[model samples]
Target chain A: MTLDTRTTVRARTATITLTGDVDAASASVLDEAIAAAAVSSPRRLVLDLNAVDYLSSAGLRCLVFAHQRLGRGVEIVLAGAHPDVAETVRLAGFDRVATIEDQVGG
Target chain B: MTAHRLVVDGLGAPSRLVAGFVSALAACAGLPPRQAYRLRLATDEITTNIAVHGYRDRGGPVDLRGRVEPEVVRVCIEDEAPPFDPTGHDPAPRVAAGPTAVLGGYGLFLALRSVDHFAYVHVGGRNRTTLCVLRCAAGG
Candidate 1:
């Protein structure tokens, strides 16, 4: 699966837009993106997964890694997650570590 | 109920194969969107586990068998690797206070939570996991 990530920082928030499937092989790309976004020390991180069709456990680990890397002060938001991805996030208890939104701006 | 089987390389990208197979099965079974998604999620988790944990990503043959019944869709994944039962394992703690908290085990945990029924067995040097998801009318 292909994973494309684009990051834009506005103010203290970094928005990372991801498209394609996030599985074991492709999770590293997301990790690098999260690391890059964390470098600016943005107070908030928004991951847009509206276009991500599939998310696996390996992908979820990348989110956990992001939460750990950004620390507690940084608010991590998962936006526009597909239904399956949302369910996996919830089941993995990611909701406790980060905020989940229906859309990026919504 | 008709059963379908698929064998894929455990070390390669199994997600696409799993998605296609599960999507077809879900469609043939008339599963709603939500149920179909759950099946796909559960299958992905188990297959990934087999590839990562069981085969250590070295590549092995993983067999998947699935069937759609009237009320539930059932799937079984079999791998001829070391015997490991995920059903008996507990999920990672929901609350991690710090970065040091262990992040492993969520794969099986999410797989368990996503399926309506989950079971594990070892027979003839094969590790088999069976998962079932109930079909709902509301499509959720």
Candidate 2:
């Protein structure tokens, strides 16, 4: 499966929409997108994971990397994660590092 | 029960194939959606570890075998690389507190937590790792 990432900036919040499986092969794609979004220096970074069907450890690592890179000033929110992905995040204890939401705006 | 073996190059591209293989096994074994997902997650993490860490810099063959029994789904991942015991490694910290918190090392942690039983053995100069997840469990 392929990973497609799109980042849009609105009112100091950069929302990244991701679709496809996030595994060892596709994690770099997400990392690069996160890096590009970080360059914008948004006040908040929101990741939309609703379309992500599979999230491997590599994907979780990328989220941690993003959390560290963005620093404490920028809030990181993982929005609309699939149940499986959300469970993995919870098991990995990543929910403490980033806010997880059932939906981006919900 | 007879185990089905699939040999693939220890590379990231083949992880998708492994996912499909395990998903089919989970369905045949009557695993619930959550349990099946956990099985898939464990399989993916282990295979990815072999591809990225076990066989790093030198590629080799990874043999994946699975069998669906009456009460459990067992999977064995065999690799002809240097012996690395996944079960021996310390799990990554559950919570990453600050910016300096390391990102890597979660692969093995997730792999171990998702399955009910995990074992590693080195025989005949091959590293064999077996993972078992309870079938039909209420919560995986």
The model with the greatest lDDT is 1
Fnat per model, in the order shown: 0.55, 0.61
DockQ of each two-chain model: 0.54, 0.59
Q: Where is model 1 chain B poorest over a 10-residue stretch in terms of lDDT?
A: B92-101
Expressed as tens digits, the lDDT of each residue in A1-106 for candidate 2 is 7899999999989999999999887888999998999898899999999899889888888887787779877888999998889989888788877899889976
The fraction of reference A/B contacts recovered in model 2 reads 0.61
Interface RMSD of each candidate, angstroms, one decimal:
3.1, 2.6
**lDDT at residue B53 of model 1 (Cα atoms):** 83
TM-score of 1: 0.90
What is the docking quality class of candidate 2? Answer: medium
lDDT (tens digit, per residue) of candidate 1 on A36-57: 9999999999999999988887
Instruction: Report, for every candidate in turn, its global Cα lDDT versus the true structure.
Output: 0.85, 0.84
Report the TM-score measured on chain A for model 2.
Answer: 0.96
Model 2 pairs whose backbones collide: none
B127: Cα error in model 2, Å? 1.1
